[model samples]
Target: MPEVKNEHIKAILAIVPEKPGCYQYFDEKGTIIYVGKAKNLKRRVHSYFNKEQDSNKTKVLVKQIRDIKYIVVDTEEDALLLENNLIKQYRPRYNVLLKDDKTYPCIVIKNEYFPRVFQTRNIIKDGSKYYGPFSSVFMAKTMLQMLRELFPLRTCKLPLTPESIANGNYKVCLEYHIKRCLGPCQGLQTREDYDKNIRIIKEILKGNIAQVSNYLYEEMQQLASNLKFEEAQKIKEKYDIIENYRGKSTIVNHSLTNIDVFSFDETDSSAYINYLHVNNGSIVQGYTFEYKKRLDEAKEELLGLAITEMRTRFNSLAREVIVPFLPDVDMSSTVTFTIPLKGDKRKLLDLSKQNVKQYKLDQLKQAEKLNPEQRTTRVLTTMQHDLQLHALPVHIECFDNSNIQGTNPVASCVVFKMAKPSKKDYRHFHIKTVVGPDDFASMNEVVYRRYRRLLDEEEPLPQLIVIDGGKGQLNAAVDALRSLDLIGKIAIIGIAKRLEELYYPDDPIPLVLDKNSETLKVIQRLRDEAHRFGITFHRSLRSKKQVLSELDSIKGIGEKTKVALLSHFKSVKRIREADQEEIWKVVGVAKGNLVIAGLKQASDKIKESKEK
Candidate 1:
């Protein structure tokens, strides 16, 4: 491990070409430590080793360079583009990498005769109408539920066929019976009627709500003219549903058609910003991003970087991005960046800034209540420094496993974003490949599956990975990451409860935190959360196994009948108390008779045992 001297810099510069290119610095183990680009490859490459030009950040970069690699390009701009791509791909430790950890579900309508509308995270080339990139899957599903109520859309996965339609073999789902769907599978609605509803849905999603309301009003008039009073009344009910939403829209400005207002503020160690999306003179959506980093740079520079990162991540960039302060750098032509000072635009910017202030206040209050010791924030700050991360670990994820002996092994990954538990991001995994109570192997499988999916999808990966064990568990996670070529890309730590210790890969002894320290408490909180989640999943598995075993002993009860019985009554205790008539109602007469007989025999056996 020889020190990287000026000679190493000269060697790199001598080999570097004059053409525009991107460069990477690798450590001794061939891990990418830093990535950079330059207009003149030789000049930029030499600047790093120049003794007089070195800052602390640059000095750290130089010390990590054991070897250099470069990719030549034709132009400077091309080099810049490639540099961004490579930085994102490798996520070098020193680069100001864009951290996009937020994801939302969208409502997609596929291009087909029977177009399906569903919630999805993926945007593929399968010609579909996507309405949103919504903040959460719950929000997307709520909107979908509302859409189903207004339009009798089909949610069934059954393939369309004339035979199935005529036979009515597929029972109408609860949605259809509750009037949320028109029972299209049962051939209850004509194609003309369904298409009309779908067209209205498309119009609403396209921000053409006035057109949809007007069309519904005209239809209502026609129904009344034809003396179909009942049909006219039904049309009026639909009109009310559309009307109710009209008042929910908050008008930012009467003149502004579509615009986005952005405002940002920063503390010594964190950044907070808000984006307000205004469409059709109304505020449609709002987003807030809390960035964590020491404010070593100017506010203008931070704001510019935040804007660029947001534009790169969010697909729905507004026509104009209104900001409170104008940066010295020139923005690309895709968006018109403006600094509004004196008019309605200025007021909107102020309002967005106020939103940022309120958001920070709310976060502080929440942090106090959630972790009184402020351990969550301290832990995030410590991890950020230890890993030399560009941003603080606002979104921390931890994994734990649970099993009794060698059966019912289950694992869970819980997320804490912004010092709060984001249960929506919590994931549960039933040990798929590994059997028995092997914690190390089970954890390795979980980490591999989770990150592999993220890599394949090109989605944002978590900032940190916390496992629930000591050296073995930490090493297992490291091995999994190495296999995927992502070992150094993510920071991994493990917590074992014996002495309340934290284990890193290179360290032999576990690092124990003071019980009174806020940082230690945060780690304990995350560890406990992972444990709770894993145990909850394991208990559910055990309960399900018990239910299946009990059902297996009964005669004339197969999997389907057992499922139906349990689903209807919800519990075995409830089913045992149900009379013959109630059982018939649950599984229908023919199947119900067999269930009743089995229940009677089981009951008789219990009675005989009691007598003995």
Candidate 2:
């Protein structure tokens, strides 16, 4: 145990109970700054002061604590529940903030004599039942639309008490005339029939459409037995509508009922939880919410917090909760936590995982769209982590060697700053030291030349260097960096074309990154850009060499005379076909005579070789 410097905290620790409950930490100003829960309150609270806190934030939190308060509970489950309530009551600055604050629409069954079903955002405590707190208004409205089509319920707000209806206080409205309502307001529809439809509406909202279908089927059969074919057909239509809707909404086997599924995803600063409520094998509710992490909370703790919040918010009474892993909360004997491995429950878990992943991706995309630099920083950070670099590779350079048939060997260096191409810094190199199509030697020469000049000129060196080759070429480049005493100064990697494998210096085994990862994509782009640049420069050199080769053999016709003739004619063959007078016009008479004679002799030599 560490030394306790604060007498107030030491006194509190001496008498604190070891029971299950929530504890509140208060600053000198008597305001609660943090709230936490634990099974053994004494040990958990003492842990803050007994050790050197690893996180700077935790250290700061401990330094400001002036008082301690707690509420005792019977079990860990009660502790979790009480902690959630207190956190909500007093949103302490150090607790993770639930980022979802939007009030989603819900289908409300208002409390009245003739209860009305409608979509609302406000909740009243007057015995009214709210079904959803749905994630989308469109989903709630779609349910309302289907209910209105299936049953002729009243849409108008009327005081349909027994006294008002008995006194004939209201009249039929346009909805009643159009057959969209049964005119309950005018006392034309019996209370039993109206309430019966409302009961069925509740069943549908609870995701029990099959039970309603069975009831309607039996009613239709009974009506037909009494020789009422028209009424029977109407009931059959209602049954068909429900059956169709159920067919469209059912997601899994019907036996998996009254279950809650939660999948977790997260990043460094935020966590996402996707919740799904399944009833009668159909999803009744699906939502994904985010939490802004205030401390280094584990996935288990954050997931437990989310599960508690979601179940309480939606009033879920599910006995079975499907999770990807066991959360850090005790559910007691009331609820069973299931980590499904296969079957229908597993499908529900997978669906939740998919939703959570997509939600995280959508959030990242939205944040990046708002601030483009965030995306760049995220990509570079990912690269640094994946490549095990000591610092962020803000400036990166990639090199590639290009050649064909041992002709015009060249290398290219493409620069990337902050994960974007810096075209002005792009450079091409001629293979000066290496002869023929020796890629390894060409890489060594260019890599040495590129950095040696940078060191000589005192220019900035790149944080990373990427070579486009396997181990052999990578070793050559590493030797060059070693020669310049730059092995430890800059990070270097080589990419193999066959497998897209990345290799670090002095390591034989390659690092294989995911094909879809952004780090791999950026490295691939740099390699491809260097290859394209080198190939273009190599081709240009080849074309120029072919044109200047034949002219170099003619000595009497000097360089100036050859340039003048070729500049006018555009090619050696064109100059050969031109008359001596045309050549004389481009050059002087002496040079023209000498150039015509040299061309004639070269043409005769080609003819003699072909004849032989």
Candidate 3:
């Protein structure tokens, strides 16, 4: 790499392309410092080396540029699109990054004879039906709970076989005890009954609750007329669940059907936009925006940009968009843009605006909560100056590994968004295809898994990846990213515990924060979170293994019998403490004898081992 200073500006300009594309700015050691897209690559690339016209930002960027790299695209629009992709992939320093990177959970129905409802963040075409891109796991779980209560669906994971169903090999799960499942595992309900309930679940998921309720009412009446009183009562119970949900649905105004409501606010130069997604006359999803720079244009322009971006990214589109202010763009004939006053639309719009207002107030409260001389904020501010970051470090992810003497090795990646912990985005890996406690290999496994998903989904990558060790771990992460073709797209730093040091790629020496520095504290928090997540995951894996190992040695205890016992007692320790009667209750006296022998052997071994 050739250094590009005032003298090399002319030489750099000579090789610049006059086409639309993205460019990379690198330092002397060929480490990328920033990445950006441009309408005219030549002009954009040349601007960096222009000595006469330099602001503080430009000067800092120029000082770091020893080499430049460019990728040519056919059109400026393509360049813009590619730029967003690369910025999201590399998370280069100069790009305007979106702080929100957490994957939203969704309800999925696997395409199977007995379709199971489960939660997932990634949407794959593995023959399954997906219902949402819900913003929160809690919301998705709540919806699933409501569905389970209203419908007699199968929640068992056991494979459905004619023999297993008839012989009662599959035991009803706790969900049946709680009346949330129909216990199809026991073959108590006919296939027709299960299919009928599935139809109702599909209707509810498709926003056809009204139609399903009407159909259920007629069915209930028919059952009563036929003198099937028990069946009628069951139908009546389902109707009550529907009716309860209906009362909550009243909060959504049906008068303004198929509308989107948006609200925008700003605090401390940061702007936020909240979007309320209305479909079939109900608000199904709400999103909040957090951006570094405040909008210089009118509110309408910001709203238009948001709407256009949302439509481009998400599959949901509304017939009308209700905004706090009018949008700057021309509305399509099928779409109406309105500012409602005196109707249900007004109420809906007001509801979105109130959320924005509350969020702005909350931001103020958060700002006030921090000490005026807060160390973390000060360190981040200093880092921004030192490294010339385009924005503050709002979303940071830290990686760490945990293992026991090269066994049960695992790694964890934990995220912190907006200076607050995002527990839902935490990920754990079992160090598959890796052996020993080699920190580098373990870190590599975790990094590859984390970013490979991001690249595949074309989702925005994290703003920063902090390793919990020194340069070795940092280099391992960098190598993993490069393998995924994502190197130079994200900021990488390592926090070494031995000296509380921070190491950046290409920096000859590690940067040590003050012992009590606020920034150092924040890094510590992130490192601690990763450690905690890894340890928790390791403990769960160990407990599961311990129980399985104990059960494996028991005579006449096949996989099914072991599963039955563990499912009933949850742990080997609990099963051992259970008397013969309790053990018989779990499987039967015939199997209980094997469990008793297993317990005695395990206990005797423990005593002998302790004596040794």
Candidate 4:
């Protein structure tokens, strides 16, 4: 290949195996920049240089390869697992980066004579049993509290060896006095009983609470049959507690056990995956994580990577896994992949999907919170993609027309810069050329006048223009842009009021975005703002016209006289309510008498019309 200039890379490619394996690419400094898994090492490695890469990222990655290395495996699953390990170990620049960094807490039963149960973040390989890497420490602590309440396990750090207890070297602390512990250190509780309780605790941590509840119920019944009323009452209370905890843990049918559910959500540059570990119908563990993509990885590929990563991280051993879709991974015959439809399994899958979506949203909100400019860039990027625009719409303008039965017709133009309303740049237009309630004509006139003025003044044109009506008004605005040869210069869209459908110039079918999409929200805001501004201007003009016609038609009442009357009374209705004595005090009796006589004549005409 012409692009494969490195002699060393060509040499490694010549002898690479045809078996399933992973490959790593290195730059001039001999640092690995990319790692990839392939079913056939030779074919996948050669495929990179064999064709003209479509993705700019892939093309750049291919150009930086100076050395190549491959490790062959027996199966595609093994290759994927190995690739995941190598990526974590090296964290290559061109590999999908796992974004999780915090270590969650786990409840551990420490390896001791009488094992101590507590919450810890560190996992030691000293034969101690660890229940969970719980989502939060609060959850771990809650489980610990429940266990301590159910069984009086020791809460002290004193050594509980048989020798120490036999010699009476340890003393029972306040925990034993309060009956919170069985005083195992002082030999008051035998090791056998404590170990029995530990076994039941393990079962509970595994989400097998029903088993423990059944055992407790039988014991409580035995105690009551023996006529031991007080002891039986205590056992009954423990049984009830176990039953309540079990009810809270059961999320689905008990038959749904040892299952792993996965769901996927993604954006342009990243993929998010949620995992739910269900045991005996209960969600024992759940996690959602993000993968920052390096290349244009397919959904199936990313899903495969995520499944491998999580399964290894959690050490999941379930034979059956529920997923939204079958990932492109080759597993052994022992494991089964299920795409569930309309059942408890489907409910778990839905829950997983919901979690992934919420996680994606929260991650975005947090990032935008830290960097306000990021939200603007993201919104404009979404707009650019949805509208199929060639560039970001940093500056946008929307037009709307308002008229009450063709009276006081006016139009408004609202400006949005960086996806926010630019109030100072907003403009209002009175319908000069159009004399009726013709929205199409008014839109055309306003658009032409607005842009023509901007063109004359050598101002920068907006990247997008939104017309607040469907096909007709949109076409009118398009014609205005065409007159100035700006049709292809700016992206324009029309939004219909009925369904919020978006219309383009040539495309008859409108593009409807998701209801929650930022692009749709911004467009809706612009349309609503333009409509509000136009309506406000229209109302003011109508009110002004009504005042002029009523007061200016009088014989002696001129501009100054009209201002004096309005300034004193604030409104015509109030002036009409005032008596002649009140009017005389404001505008002098001579003009005031004429004003009172004129207003009284107008009010009498209105009353006569209503009577007819």
Ordered from best to worst lDDT, the candidate numbers read: 2, 4, 1, 3
lDDT of 2 by residue, 314-428 (tens): 9999999999999999886778999999755876788788668766876787677668899999999999999999989999999999989888788899999999999999999
- TM-score of model number 2: 0.54
In TM-score terms, candidate 1 sits at: 0.37
Encode model 1's per-residue lDDT on 424-498: one tens digit a residue: 999999899996789899989999998899899997877777888888988998899989998767778888888
lDDT of 2 at 231: 98
Q: Highest TM-score, which number? A: 2
State the local distance difference test value for candidate 2: 0.84
RMSD of each: 28.8, 17.2, 30.1, 17.4
lDDT of predicted model 3: 0.72
* Segments in model 2 whose C-alpha atoms lie over 4 Å from true places: 1-250, 298-301, 308-315, 326-336, 551-570, 579-598, 608-612
Q: List the residue pairs that clash in candidate 1.
A: 375-518
- Give the per-residue lDDT digits (tens) of candidate 4, residues 66-132: 8776654445644554465466657889886431233446678889999999988676768777655
Better of 2 and 3 by lDDT: 2
Candidate 4, residue 151: the lDDT equals 91
- Candidate 4 stretches with Cα past 4 Å from truth are 1-256, 268-270, 291-347, 370-372, 512-517, 554-561, 573-612
